[model samples]
Structure formats: structure tokens, C-alpha cells
Target: MIPIQLTFHGAAGTVTGSCYRLDIGDRHVLVDCGMFQGDKTIKQLNYQPWPFDPRRIAAVLVTHAHIDHSGLLPKLVKAGYAGPIYATPGTSDLLQFMLPDSGSIQEMEVERLNRRNQRRGGGIVQPIYTEQDAQDCLRLLAARDFGSWFDVTGGLRARFWNAGHILGAASIELEVETGGARPLRLLFSGDIGPEHKALQQEAMAPSDLDIVVMESTYGGRPRPKLDDSQRRAVLAEEVTAALAAGGNLVIPAFAVERTQELLADLTRLIADGTIKRVPIFVDSPLATRITSVFAKYLHQENGIKAGAARPFDGGNLRFTRTVQESMQIEQVTGGAIIIAASGMCEAGRIRHHLKNNLWRSNATILLIGYQAPGTLGALLEKGERVVRIQGDEVAVRAHIRKLEIYSGHADHDELLDWLTNRLPIHGSLMLTHGEPDAIGALHASIALWRERAPQVIVPKLDETYSLAKAQPRLMKMTQQSRRLDRYAETEAISGHDWHNDYARLMLQVQHQLRTAKSDLDRRRLLKKMQRILGRGAGTD
Candidate 1:
């Protein structure tokens, strides 16, 4: 039997609901059981049963605290996985805010579904995970610091490095040994951040790896580039323009970083008296709690630790903790600023606020994050004339604006550079966590990579590979010089003519090469085709 195997269970070909499983002999580990967000088709996958047995997992290793990457932990526990879940201390703190809030979302969704079910004489519906499940899940979490190696499975040692994608975000590296011998190193590059973010430290790249899994969220398209100064200038201008026109600016942001960053910017503007200190309200209870977490960790921030005072606590910054307080935001009348979540406007207090203010011509909706393809946030960002909220259609008469600086993921060119700098040529690569177009673009880009150096593989969900078993195919193709041998046979068979058939065969070969998961597979197939075609016996 082979020593090690890696299986991708989630985050393969789609951007949300990330989960992966690793096995070495009798030991097993699961990584990042996240909930799927975005289109209803993708979100529905979250309700389906897991592909593997949760009970068999020895432990759960979380990469970060983002809901798309950590939301399903409670559900895993509820389904009877009692093992310790490991993460950095910062992730643990964020989970304290994320888990219960996710539970509340699940409860709310289930309640709404049940009421509809009753109306249609269908059975009562239950939440996928409850707050109690989240509490139980928390008891099992063991927070560890980065840069320290810990024994993870029977023959596997693991460590984390800062990903800089979010506070306490990490990229996981695992060294697996089978039968107490033959070490295999695999690195999981969780969501990554660019070098330019304000609060995060710079991202780190490792020197070498046997297999590397990378995310490709922005691989297909380039995000609009603007320097930090330009971003801030645009934001300030939008705010002042809205206020000058007697409009209140409403921003739907991720509670952790985007909300706080926007608030910090507003505080700077108001303190300098560049803009009026209009009433600003944070209307999501989850955001309110997360803001407290951020404050507690202020010393951990890059520049803020040097005794830089935070403006989130006072001066027009108000946190609304109750539904009533959130609803009261409607009475702010004019020229106030409001921030809320879920950033996509799919749920949470933002929907309530959007429904109340969307019809008003004087209101402005500001988007600060990546809106998934089928989300309400995407609709608004695309200038849809109407959006449905809570089963009622609301006219999108409000001014819609965007500030792209709020993105947490790295862009296209950044992804390629990260891969080239971090991984040795011998290492294999897996591209995941993107839509089909993004993944396809990255897949093509990696081919150019394979032509020069290193083995690359774009893995798919449920594709299993024996880590040790893949070495020979790569060795044979590189050492034997099969292309040279094919050339020699081509010279001997040059007189034969079958151009049309050869073209058809070549087209099929190209398709297989494009679809093959790894360079090793491509090499193997090329060698086989060389033999089958009698080395250029036909012309194209």
C-alpha cells in the first residue's frame, strides 16, 4: 500500500465551502469544513450530506475564521465529530464571533423554511446546526501559535505560517510519513492577501514543497488597480458627494476587516474636519461583537500597536446590538452613514436596511467586497433596477457605488508570482476555490509554467492520488526523452499521408492534455499516443 493519499472534498472548481481530507495509513485529518455561499445551486450543496464520514476524522484543522472557510465546523460537530479542532489563537477569537452568528443565520433560515412548509402542508424543517452545536464545537478547539510544528496524525507533523489574508489567517503545511518512513510535504495555500493591505503583515512564501494547493478566486480577471491613496480619495469623494446631495451612504461590509477599515477611514476624515461628523451606525449585532474582538487584538495590528489610538470606540461610531436598534436606523433621516453585513445582502441586518432605504433616491449603497455571481450584492453592483428582499421586491433607486480596496484575496498576477516564488519546480500544484472561468484561466497559465519547470496538477473534488505512486511517471517522462524518440520515428514514417485523420487525432490529444490533472498524467498519455500513432505515420 502507498504511504500517503490526498483527497479534495471541497473548494474544487467553486469559490465557497472549502473542505479537504488527508489519509496516511490508519490516521485521518480533515481541513476546513466551510459553508458554501453565493448562488442558490452552490448554497444548496451545503445541505447535502458530506462526501466522507465525519466520525472517522482524527482532527479538524481550520485555515482561518471566514464564514466560507469555517462556517461548517458546527455542523461537523453536530454530526458527531468529537475530535479537537486546531487553529491559531486569533482564529479562535474570530470563531467566537463567526460560529454563533452562523448558527443564528441557520436558525433564521430554518424558521422561515418551516413557516413556508406549514403553509404548503410540508413537514417542519430543522436548522443544519444550532447555537448549542457551536458551543460544543468551541469546546473542542485547541488554539496554537504559528511557526511551531505539532504532531497532527499518526505519522504527520504540521505547522502554519501567516497567510496575511485576515487577522490570524494561516497557510497550512503538512509533513506526512507512512509506516514511520518516507516523508511527504504538502502545503495548503489558504486564501491569501496582497502586499498592500493596511493592517496585515506581508505574506510569506516557502522555499519548497512536494504538493501545493492554491486558490484562484481572481485568476480569470484582474481587479481594478488603485493605490491606497487613490482608494481613500475615491471613497472620501463618494461620501462627500452623497452628503452634498443630501444622501446617506450605506455600506454593506464584512464585519471583521472591511467594516472596521471603513470606520477607521471615516474617523480620519471627520477628525481632520474634511467631512462632517455625521451620525454613523453599525447595525449588525455580529459586526458589533466582531468589532470588540478586533479592538481586543489591536495591539497585534501592524501600525496600530505603536500607541496609535483607534477611532472605532467613540466619535460618531455607534454599535447597534439589537434588532430594534437596527430597525431604528431608518429614522436617521438624512446625511448619516450606516454599515452592516452580510456583505452580499443575502441575509442579516443589511437586508433590513437595504429594504428600508433602497427606494429612497437620496440613499447610496456602497459595496466593498467581492459579490458572488448570483448574490443580491452582485445584482446591486451590476445596476439591477429591482432586488427582492424577504420575498418583497424593492426598487433600486438608491445610488450604487463600489470601493474595490476592501478585497481580501490576491489578484491574478499576484497568484502566479506567489506560486513561482514559493514552490520548487518538482512540486505539483492544485488550483481550486474559483469559478469555472477563473480555474480555466489559471489552468492555462500553469501549462506555461509546466513547459519551463516543475510538475503541476489542477485537482478536482473526489480525485484521489497516491503521493508516492505518482513519482515514477514523472521520472520516466523526464529521463527517457520520449519526445526525442517520437521525432526519430517520425523521420522514418514521413512518406505516409493522412492529414484529415491526423488533425482529428491531434485535436483529441489536445483536449486530453488540457483536461489532465497533472503534468505527470499528460506525459504518460503523450508517451502512449506516441506508441499508438507509430510516431508521425499520419500527417496533419
Candidate 2:
């Protein structure tokens, strides 16, 4: 038997929370433990318990340091997972700053919730994890260089290549040798970035794979072909107009990769005198710290090595680490450039800057990344005349500019190009990590590949299909029955109901069954029910 079972724990339908679990015999490895973004229902999913025990996970491989790729590491550690967490050297350094800061924010949020509940005569609420837990996770990190394959489990070797999405982003390839002589190769495109980014090298193309899992972040949009030079030129025009007004320019950027890329571009622009030399302030302490870490790892890749010099040092660039320094930005009467986070303006120092400058006609708000719907940044990007920030309503007088060219993710055409380099002469293909329409667009493009060699599959969230192995007789069992079988001894001794009680016992299983059909639905339902009612008493 080929000892392998794959499950998409997260990043199935939505873009955030990029976790995929692969089981090879007794060893289980999870790829990327990210946090869910936007969609309150999905965000609420973060608070739920894991489907499997965290300790059962042998190790974790992080694709990058973006919050969506590495946010949940601290939570995993807090859950008692004690195993090596693998990442590129740059990702490891960035996480040292990001995870702890995220932990601090989570702790503060929980504290605030507890205090507010106390005012309403309720008890305290514990945070998901503390900064201490994050620190502990950091201790588990083992940094590795890219392009090197390392053994993860029995016959499973993994390697990473440049994804070009962010500073340390990568696409992963895992070769799992079955009990047979032949090994199955799987490729995971971890948020494929734009090909010709100024801050990073173009994404690499894989030669071959048995199974391919690709991201579709920009899958919904048409490919707007623009290289790094084209992107810089477009940005220069915007910066020129914004500075000519002699007011502040606010850029809401992700602290890790986007900020660094923006800084590099600004450096070149200033060096060329295309954009005037003005005070540029980076206001987020976490971003400022991560910037330093990025500097340390510049030699790891061709992109960073090319722009080896400290782009943000000397000149007018200033890193504002203190709240005092952030506040002092208001005193700048002349034109200034401010880069802050969170990228979508959902939270962070960017909100303070927006609040201070939104009503100023001379100020400009530059949006550089995707804004999840319902976020403050999305509203502003959509051209709302006014928005509320920190309880106060502010009029929108600042010029709102969007330079979509600065996106790190690949566009539709670029995605197709990357796929063309990997598809077999006559094999199957699978597409994941994109929205419905975008997935459809990719599906259409897949037809072009099918003309050459037909066999492409696009799966919905929670959907499962059998691999090449022969079908298992166990597929006929109900979900509840499977659940009871897994925990039969405990349920029997504890006298736990295997029907009604189990229905309430496992919400994750219930959710999985709600949309499942036929054999899959039957198995999931039986397992859940039998776990509650005890054995041999149910219709399943």
C-alpha cells in the first residue's frame, strides 16, 4: 500500500490560511499554518479546535513569512506541538519578529474582550496564545536554504524554489516514494507571485509532477502584463503628483515583502531624481524590525543580492519605532512619504496615518495590495467619500491612487505560463487557491493544455477523490461509524452516545459532511454519530 493520504485543511476556497496536511505512514507534515482573513465565518473558524491532534503532526514547513502563510505557528506551538518547523533562512528571521508581534496583538485583543465582558459581569477570556508561546515556537524553527531537498518523513523529500511573491516566498515540491519503486511527486505553488517583480526574481518553473496544487489569488483578474520597469514608471508618475502637492503620502503595505519592495523602488526613484528627495517614514515597528531581518538575508537569493545596498538607509528614509515618532509625523508641513501597515488598513499604524491625513487635500493614499472586502482599505479603494477610523468619522479629501502593478501575485497569463512549464506531455492537472470565476478562467486555460494532453481536475472545498490506488472497502462506512471505529474503545468505556451526542461532539466533522455526498457523506455522518451513541445501535 502507498502510505499517503492528503487533506486540504485550509486555503481550499478562500485565499488565507494556507495549510495542507500530508500523511506518509505514521508521520504527518503540515504545510503552512496561516490565519483566515476577512469573511467573519472563516475568521471564526480560527477559534475552533484542530481536526487532528497537534502533537500528531511531525513537523511544519512554512512557505514564507506572510501572515497568511505563518500566522498560526504560535497557536500550533501553544497546542503542544513540539517538532521542528522548517523555513528558509529569511522566513525564519522575519517570523522572529512577525509571530511575536502577532501574538502580542492577539493577547491584547483577548485582554480587551475580557475587560469588556467583565464590565458586563462575565469572566475572563484567555488569548489563543501569548507572546511567550510565540517565542517558544521560534525555538522550534530550523532554518534551511532554498533549492535543497531534505527528508521530511519516510521516503518523503521536499525542496523549495522562488515563488517571487514576497521577500522569502517559495513554491514547494515534495517527492513521496511509495512502497513500490516509483515515487509520486507533488508540487505546491505557494502564492505564485508576479514574474518580473523589482524586489524579487521571477518565479521558477517546475519540470514535472504527479500532482500540482496552484494558487489562484489573481485567478479572477485578467493578466495585466507589466514588468518591473513598467511598474516603476507607473509608480513614479503617482509619486510625482502626490509630492507636488507638498502634503503627506500614505501607503498601506504589508510590512514584510511589500514594504521592502516599495522601499527598493523608492530608493531607485530617489537615486534617479525621478521622485524628489523627501522624508520617508516607516511607522510600524514590526515592519521596521522585519526590514532589518530582510537586510540580513539579502544574500540568499538573486533578487535581493542584485539590490544588495541598503535602499532605506541614509537619504531621507526614517524608521519610526516609537508611538512618539509616529505622532511627530503630523508636524511635517512639507511633502513626506509614509509607509505603514496593515496592508488593507484593517488595523495598525496605517489607520493612524489615514486618520490624520485623509481630510487633507494635499495628502495621498496609495493602495498597493489586494484589499479583502469589508475592510476599511477596500472601502477607500472603492472610492468612498468618507470613512470612520478609530470611532471618529473623517472626510476623504486625500487623493486615492491605486498602483495594481505592484501586486506580488501572478496574473492570469503569468499563472498559465508557469503551468505550461510544468504540465506533462499527457497527464493530469489540478487547480486550487482561487475564487470561483478565477478558477473558471484557469479552467478555460486548462482546456488549452488539455488539447495537448487531456486530464485536468478542479476541486471545490472539502471535496475528495481517490488517487491511483485501488478503492478501499472502508469507503462504504458512514462518517459516524468511522468516528466510532477510531475511538470505539474510549466511547465504549465512557458510555458516550454515538448518535445524538456525537453530532454535537464534532463541529468540524459535521461541517465536512454538510456538503459531502454519496460514499463520502455516508462515511463522515456515520463516524460522527457512532462516536456519540456507542456501537451497533444506529441506522448508519
Most lDDT-accurate candidate: 1
Q: Largest TM-score belongs to which candidate? A: 1
Q: After superposition, how far is residue 307 of candidate 1 from its true place, in Å?
A: 9.9
- Candidate 1 lDDT over 1-540, as tens digits, reads 545667766776667778888877767798788887765545655777776678989998999999889999998988889898999888898898789888988898889978988999999867878887887789988987888899876777889888878888889988877443446777888998875665566667575777787899888666766665566677788889888767678888888777877776777777777778888999888888877777877766421221238747565788988878877888875789999988888888888889888998998888987887667897788887766677666778999988767688888877877787875735577778887678778778877764655565655545565677434121112322221234322321221124323433655677689899999999999888777777568532
Number of backbone-clashing residue pairs for each candidate, in the order shown:
1, 24
Q: Kindly provide the TM-score of model 1 when superposed on the true structure, using C-alpha atoms.
A: 0.83
Cα lDDT tens digits for candidate 2, 1-540: 655666666666557777877777788899999986653345554776776689999989998888888888888988889998988777787888999988887887787678778989998877767888899899999877789899877678889888887777788888877776667777888988776676677888477667777887777576567766777788899999998887888999998878888888888888877888888899999988987876776665433643537765656889998889989987875588999999989777788889889999988999997876546787788897766675466789999998778787888888877887886623346566665567778778777654564366665333344444422111233353222233442332222225324323454454466667677777967876777666566644
**lDDT (Cα, 0-100) at 151 in candidate 1:** 85
What are the clashing pairs of model 1? 425-454
Off by over 4 Å in 2: 113-125, 299-308, 425-428, 462-465, 469-540
